[model samples]
Target: MKSNNTAKSFDYTGLKRVISLGLSQSKGLFIGVIFIAVFSACFSVYRPYLTGDVIDNYILNKDLVGLKLEIFKLIILLIFEGILAFFTVYLANVVAQRVIKELRVRLYNHLIKFKLGYFDRTPNGVLVTRSVSDVETIAEVFNDGILVLLGDALKIIFIVAMMYYMNWVLATIVIVILPLMMIITRYFQKALKDVYQEERTLVSKLNTFIQERLTGMNIIQVFNRQQAEYSKFSSINNDLKKNYLKTVLYFSLLFPVVDIVSALATGSLIWFGGLRTAAAGDVTVGNLIAFTQFITMLTAPMRAIAERFNSIQRGLVGADRVFDILDANETLPNNGKKKLEKVKGKIDFENVEFSYVPNNKVLKGISFSSQPGETIAIVGATGAGKSTIINLLSRFYDIDSGSIKIDGIDIYDMDLVNLRHHVAVVLQDVFLFNTTIFDNIILGDKSITLEQVQEAAKVIGIHDFISSLPNGYYSEVSERGSTLSVGQRQLISFLRAYIYNPEILVLDEATSSIDSNSEELIQLATTKLTEGRTSIVIAHRLATIQNADQIIVMDNGMIVEKGTHESLLAKNGYYANLYEVQFSKMNS
Candidate 1:
């Protein structure tokens, strides 16, 4: 079932916490960034002051020497301001990259620790988006967005202070337009945020569609569904395009509107400052020129603030998605009570009941026990809860009620890792990485020698087949072992389990996919693999398990009959009927 809380908005509290965490890691660079921003703002104020000084002290008095000195001072201040700006950008970029790297690591580690159920429910594309695109967005916010906000805020404060000191009446005229600009910007920011968020969601969906299609391309071709797939992809692509256009349109309108407002503010300053100078003679020509420049400067910071706010909104959206994954509950605790230095391989299941969902039980009050080194065979129709029993015994999922003990201790009380270490399963569907055959076989114990790998393969009757290949045991398998046949993959899986030397061995229809010749070899290998271990074989072929010490017949999540094959045949019950059906099919 899907989570109920999926539709919630981005967590603002979590976002603030993440920002705080990032700042704490690179506090020094953060402090330096602020210092440089303030330094640049102060330097910006000096230019207008120097220009006013040039007009009052030199131009008005016809002092050429003083004009030359003021110009030189302006040049020096510009150079210093340039240096400060460069360092501020450089330091912020450096810190942003470092913090992003650490954040990525932390996110990846958290994902790895999450329970298998999380991966089962989450789409791979969605997780990939959080790790890649989301991190990139946050990095941009740190590097460019934060710096813009800091620099512009300081610049705006300094400019307003200077404007008021020079002439309150002219400053008031310019400031009057600001409140309207702010109101308009507030509306624009809200509308833009929604548009951008929609765009981001569409992008994520498109990514997921592409990833799923590419991974299953073979199935599409086999089913002649290429046209259908193309149509689906095109539909999503068009939606993405629409979202992108909407986002761009909103931004386009916002930028031009802000620019027009700033222009109007500038015209107001020029007109009002001219009238004041005409009346009082207190404002010189150079001071009026400086006031115009200050009004122009106001535009830069306003635009910067608008852009920064836009970035922050998008960043919050991305952060919300990332944190959603990080906050998922982990797997149930494996707090098995018994700790065994060595397992004797006896396993018992008593009155075990389990259900992935309530009122839909898959395994019902099952009861059974196997002696150490005994081979127990389970036979049943499809959906008979055969696999569910193995899953429960392996502790993949806890039982709803009842007890399962391995070597006489409750499975839940044993250390999870240690318990899993001693149990091995060879399943019908095998998964192999893109690595050498030897490496695949030795996956359970990488420290084992190559000779040990060969020995295990030989026991599983796959050594000759592996050696016949061009690279022999060193031959590299393709991803998912696509280059190998199903039978060959199963052989490799058996070898892997054999190499682990597990105390308990499980074969869940392991030989069902192999040909008769390979099945014979696998049966022989299975005998060797389970020679000294407790073995549970879930199979459809009755002949294969005829020699088992115990045979269980399960139907609809219950063990209907249990006994030796000979005894069950004598009883003429569920096992006898199942055996006859299979035997008649084989004879025919």
Candidate 2:
């Protein structure tokens, strides 16, 4: 879980995987788009030659009736072309949107299965960018880019063929310029692709910075460091600006090179074709005119090819990043098929060795157990692995060694979904969604009714407090329940766990930050929440867990002492020392 802010190299394997996945799922739509594009290319190639025919057959001959007829036909073709262009844009987006929907869902499913430690190192903003901004960039590859590119490429091919059929010598003049244009374009592609990746990385960094600063705005304002924070943001903003400018710089240079090459091709067509027409009386004036237009058509697609090629490269960069997440080896395994209809909640951990990072063990061979309907409290200093126990039992992270069991059955052999469902937790830092209080309590468990929520709230003695709100259980809580007090959030969490009706309940320092009044209410609620359930409480106050059937004191990842609170106080060891310190603070 160690954080590494290193740059990624180009991953073509990932690029291919992304392309295959997107194309395979959108095969019919892609074929339809290509067919439309080819039709557009045919019209493009035929139009210039049609214009040449009009010049030679009507205007030069002065046959006004025939000219009128040809002009009317051309108008009809132009209208049809417009309609084709419209569908080309529309259908490309339809395909892109469908592919993006599937990819985004796949990314979410893969990301959620990642081990908790993976998130410890991965920033929230970076992931947000992955699922949102980067995915959009990938969509642009098809929507704004690839469909147009296909039309342009076919147009170029058809134009070249028409020119050669009219006059090969004139076609040769156009062909000679292409190699140089492609070379310049290749350089632009490499240059733009590199900068695009750097640009995306900078964007992710900026997002991370913004997300962190906004979340910690209270801290920044209290310390009056707004100016300092502004300066840091400016620095990041400048880096993004510079990265963007590098892409712009490459584009700025590329367009001028393309323009110069285009002028040279057009000039050669007019000069050489004029001379040959004058000397040999073979090449027609109409051929010269058509050749210039043909060169224009061809060079436009070349420019497009370069531009769209750059866009595709940018999409590939995004695809590489997304694939990296999907390809990670850190997902939690769900190979076990055993399901529990009703858990008896007898839990055991034997010689459990665990670590967030390699060789930096956080839980060292800890052994403990709780029988059904029994209550156990884990007492420990910060980083002594108290919370780590809950994490392992719920399979949030797999233990490095040894076993955890519930009701004499190994938890690793139990269905992960069922195991998590029955082992409910009210975290110290409760997170409430910005929604109605009733929704937060029910949390999408359709089996639980609103009445059940009220019943549980009453059991926890918060029914009156809830009903006092303007909308009762329907009252909206602000983001992360900032509108509610810490204790109130804790109470809602208790109600959430209770409504779920899990067989094992974990209260990890649930009352640590609450006011005395809230603590008393929670103490009354705890009895009802823990009744008939195996309960594990981790608390610093010590008073909340004094009646715990067993208390285990840990230090530096090892269980240093274990017994009931009174029995441990009699032993006068680590638990006794911690209890005495808290008791003295309360007395003072």
- Among these predicted structures, which one has the highest lDDT? 2
Per-model root-mean-square deviation over C-alphas? 3.0, 2.3
**Over the stretch 1-588, how does candidate 2's per-residue lDDT look in tens digits?**
211222333345654665566578788887888999999888878877888888888998999999999898889889888988898889888877887788899999989888898899899989998888888777777876677788988898888898899888888998888889879987777677678777888889999999999989999999999999999999999999999888888888888888899899888878888888889977887788888888888888898898888777777777767767777788899888899899888999999999988999999999988889999999889999999999988999989999999999999898899889889998999999999999998888788888888878888899998999999999999999999889888988988888888999999998888976687788878888998899999988798888899998999999999899889999988888888898899899
Model 2: lDDT equals 0.86
Models 1 onward score TM values of: 0.90, 0.96
> Positional deviation of 266 in candidate 2, in angstroms?
1.4
Range of the 10 consecutive residues with the lowest summed lDDT in candidate 1: 1-10
Q: Which residue pairs collide in model 1, if any? A: 335-412, 336-412, 336-413, 336-414, 337-413, 337-414
- What residue runs in model 1 are displaced by over 4 Å at the alpha carbon? 1-11, 55-68, 336-339, 438-446, 449-451, 467-474, 515-521
User: How many pairs collide in each candidate, listed in order?
Assistant: 6, 0
**Alpha carbon lDDT of each predicted model:** 0.82, 0.86
The runs of at least 3 residues in candidate 2 whose Cα sits more than 4 Å from the true structure, single-residue gaps closed, are 1-16
